[model samples]
Target chain A: MRRAVGALLRKDLTAELRTFESIPAMTLFAVTTFVLFHFGLDRSSLEGDLAAGVLWVTLLFAAVLGQNRLFVAEEEQGGFDGFLLAPVDRTALFVAKALALFAFLVVVEIVAVPAFGLLLLGPDLLDPLPGLVLVLLLADAGIAIVGTLVAGLAIRTRARDLIAPLLTLPLLVPVVLAASEATAPLLAQAGAEGPPGRWLAILAIYDLTIGLVAYGVFDFLLED
Target chain B: MQAPAILVRDLHKSYPSIEAVRGIDFEVARGEVFGLLGPNGAGKTTTVEILEGYRERTAGIVSVLGHDPGQRPRTLRERVGIVLQGGGVYRHVTVRELLDHWAHLYPAPRDVDEVIELAGLGGKQHERTRSLSGGQRRRLDFALALVGDPELIFLDEPTTGFDPAARRAAWQTVRTLAELGKTVLLTTHYLDEAQALCDRVAIMKDGRILTIGAPAELGVGALYRVVWRDAETGEVQSRETEDPTGLLHQLTSAALARGEPLRDITVARPSLEDVYLDLTEEPSAAASQEVRDG
Candidate 1:
């Protein structure tokens, strides 16, 4: 299982590097979302405590672009049949794919955050960015787990584009709420401190619970 | 006591309106190419998927490699390799990456390079799978299916779109697997492929096996067709008879007696396709059709 997970993770990461498939679109989405947030809410009267909520919401949606393409990485040429033929545990297949998407979302957010900081929010608006990064990572992992499964199902359907996001977003709301709560303090202040760790714990539990659910249910979805 | 590699008893599956496989029964030995020959929409794919542990059966018991496929699929699948109808190589990843990825999934896998060589993808190992031709990608699919060195392999229409040269190469690949003594369950619409590769074949229609046998032994004993030129009419005539040798002797002796040669003589026997059609042709006598006239 370890070997299978490593190989699959490497395969997907390498494929993402080869294509640069999701990052550009995700980056553009994050940047424009940031700019729109700043323009609409930067004023003294309109600047609100919902900056973190908006940011998490933006990042969560951007992940849909990344996650929906997960199975496509293995689907384009002839990979689906190969995957079915492999001897690995099916649950490992689900986990490794989710991890790969989580990693990609992290990479895009790493760049997008700084770019968003410079271009939209004043450069110093989000201080101690590491905590927010943690929130984003956790939330993104949740999104990827559910999104990856839905993407797997949707890719097999005739109406994939319409169905993937529909299947993904409903599961995404909990992650978005938890992550926004975790980041709200910092997003609303020059530098604020609260028990963001509690929110992180909630995010972790959701990830563990939802990850297992998706893993256990993958076989049902994978079958004809 | 040894057991069959695959045992499917009274299996059944249905879509919204049709039962694709209705109470089918069969067993495959450990080292034979078992052919499931049927026309399009005859439920071959559904039955193969059920046997591979990739689809749920509506009824019946199915055991592949000693585990019930529908109940404990992973236990069965780890030892089974499958090339589903069109599920082949992934396009975005390089060939090396895809093979290496699938290779790692097996409990114990063959060398990745050896697999690439086996699949004939040595030169294109670094190319993106999408960049390879249809045939190359198919070779990659075969490589992945072969990676785990599975005890049983399920190939569903493995060479559907291949050109002649590619098809022959794939046949060679199948021959290699048989040489390795691997049990392969093959489903195909192409009778020639069934004739060339399978040791035994089961002809099916409307979700039932019509007959099963060694290809050559399938039909009623071969009938010989005799053709000859008729003297005054100048038109050739043909006839089928069970005793061609005796008929030929009698005809020639009569011709000799009449002082005329038996010209344009021809003799032929039934081939597998003839037997296949005979075995698989539906007897509408058993079928009740809903007829409408305008």
Candidate 2:
């Protein structure tokens, strides 16, 4: 199972590196959205709730872009059928895809968060770096799991590009709610602080619950 | 003494408004190449998918390698390989990369290089799948199916779009697999292909098995066709006969006495193609009315 997951993840990462299909588009979309937000809000810098809201919303939308393309290779290229024929547990695919999406999210955030810091954030990003990392890790897990599930559901549909975002956004509301609420204090102009414990708890719980559910149901979606 | 590779009894599958497969039964022995011949929408795909554990049967028992495919046990999947009708490869990934990745999914996969060579993808291993032509992509699909070294392989219309040469190459590969003691279940509309490769075939029409047997025996018995031209009038003549040899002897003798050869004399048996078209076409108009009136 571990070997299968590793192989699948490696294939996805290598393909991404060669094609530059998803990550660059996502990263560029994130940075551009920040620029748009800066102009749209008519503010040189955002602080506290406004800063948190902008960063999380931008990340969410960018993540949606990645999710839209998640299973496209499999859907278009017969990757799903090949994978299905394998003896490995079907959940191995779910785990591999979720991890790959998480890695892509990390790459996107590596660029987007700094852009957020440079352009829109009023507070010092370094002050809350450790706490911010924890919040991002937890929030990204929830998004990754839910994103993979939604991608599988929508990829086979005729309106895949449209259905992906529509299905994912509703399922990701809790992740957004908890992530934004948690990051708001970290970006406050007054002084940076750790994320609130309840929001962290919410993020963790949502991630765990969704992960288990996705693991259980993923095989059914692969059926003809 | 071994169990049949596939044993489907009274199998049935129905959509909300259509009975796609209605009580069909067939068995394929191990190491045999069995062809499921049908026209479009004849429930060939549904039955194959059910056996592959990709679709649920509405009713009846399906045993693939002695296990119920409906449960989709890992053991059964490990033993069965499938080449689906559609859904292709990762366009951005090289052929070698995709093969290597698929190899890791099975417990004991065939060597990636060997599979690449077997599928006629030797020199193109480094090329991205998207760069491959249609025939090349189908070869890649074939390579992926064999990489697992499955005991039973399901090929759904494996050569629908191949050129003549490629089709012959695929047939050779299927023949080699059968020689290697692997069981193959092939679905195709090409009667000649079925006749050439299959040890036995099941002809399907309107979600039912119209007939099942060796291709030669499946056609109506003693129905040989003789065609010739009248030497004097230059008019063509034809007849269907049970005794082609006797008829040929009498025709040639009479023509010799007349000092003219029996021009264009040829005797042929009814082909699998003839039987298939007859079986599938005979029921359509009546079946449509039955469906409409149901």
| Per-model tally of clashing residue pairs | 8, 4
User: Tens digits of per-residue lDDT for model 2 on B1-294?
Assistant: 888999999999999999999999999999999999988999999999999988999999999999999888989988998886545477777899988888899999999999988889999999988888877877888888888899999998999999988798789888878888989999998988999999999999889999999887876684899999999899999999899989999999999898997889888877888888878875578898999999
The parts of candidate 2 lying over 4 Å away from their true place are A158-167, A170-173, A188-191, A194-199, A220-224, B14-18, B86-88, B217-224, B240-245, B274-294
How far does residue A35 in candidate 1 sit from its true spot (Å)? 2.6
For every model shown, what is its TM-score relative to the native structure?
0.84, 0.88
> How far is A1's C-alpha from truth in model 1 (Å)?
2.4
lDDT of 1 at B5: 94
The superposed Cα distance between candidate 1 and the true structure at residue A4, in angstroms, equals: 2.2
* C-alpha lDDT of all candidate models, in order: 0.78, 0.90
User: Residues A63-89, candidate 1, lDDT per residue (tens digit)?
Assistant: 888877778745654456556655556
Per-residue lDDT of model 1, residues B4-74, tens digit only? 99998999998898889988999999998999998887789899988766688999988888888776455
Per-residue lDDT over A29-113 for candidate 2, one digit per residue giving the tens place of the 0 to 100 score: 9999999988999999999988988989899999999988888888776777777767888889889999999999999999999
